[model samples]
Target: MSDQTGSAGVVLKYTVSPDDFTRAGEASSKVKNILKQMGISPDVIRKVSIAMYEGEINMVIHAHGGEITVTITPQEVLMELKDVGPGIEDVEKAMKAGYSTAPEQVRALGFGAGMGLPNMQGCTDEMKVETELGVGTTITMSVHMEDK
Candidate 1:
């Protein structure tokens, strides 16, 4: 399903599966395609895609699964990821580079570099994270559109 604004912008949603390395980047890839079809700038698309991809992977490795909603408008692209996995205990520690809690099997696959949250923050113009110890985590990120 999608929501339309005055300018015909689009909102897309995807469900992430647990430990699904083979399909990890699918959601981000789809978002990139949608942005391209809408004639969004490549730079903006790149930033959103990278951030979304990282979040998706984190959901797979840590959260077991999650849901992501992406909203594209004339002004910015917003991505919201909600997961039912163990919530982050320390947001500050999690944000540090080279710090990861991923299992060995996951790290062997060339992921779990401890860069997911940081990378997401770096790529987005705005970001907010809400997490509960045993409940879940929700991350909202936005990338503003730039004039061509």
Candidate 2:
């Protein structure tokens, strides 16, 4: 880990709206800009942005939107995404690279190629997904900073 700059960490929150395709990635983009302004490493920013954006898209397409909380510190960047939509029936299946539960409508939009979870797991240092069939889901992911 690198920086210990933020005393407790800088926290940012955002809301994802159902079917808000137009604004789906706004929060992630804003975070990327903020990271840049804070002089975060490019690799870290890229990983964080990719994970956050994928989560946002998943919420819009399957989970009927959700809320996202991100904490930035010198040591790492953490993001937690929560949704109240139908939870993943099979976490194992959903984690498959090409597996998608999106309906035809979502697929037709060219956004549901089943890569959200895979990509999220790929770029982050650690990731966790907690879900209930009809209750909701919460995904927590973190990307740790490293010494150059």
Note the Cα lDDT for every prediction shown.
Answer: 0.89, 0.90
At residue 146, what lDDT does model 2 achieve?
Answer: 74
Q: How many residue pairs clash in all the candidates, one count each?
A: 0, 1
**TM-score, predicted candidate 1 vs. hidden true structure:** 0.93
Residue 102 shift from truth in candidate 2, angstroms: 0.7
lDDT of 2 by residue, 19-135 (tens): 888889998998899899999999999999999999999999888899988888778999999999999999999999999888898888887888999999999999999999999
lDDT of 1 at 59: 92
- Give the root-mean-square deviation of each candidate in angstroms: 1.8, 3.8
lDDT of predicted model 2:
0.90
Q: Please provide the root mean square deviation of candidate 1 (C-alpha atoms, Å).
A: 1.8
Give a tens-digit lDDT track for model 1, residues 44-64: 999999999999999988898
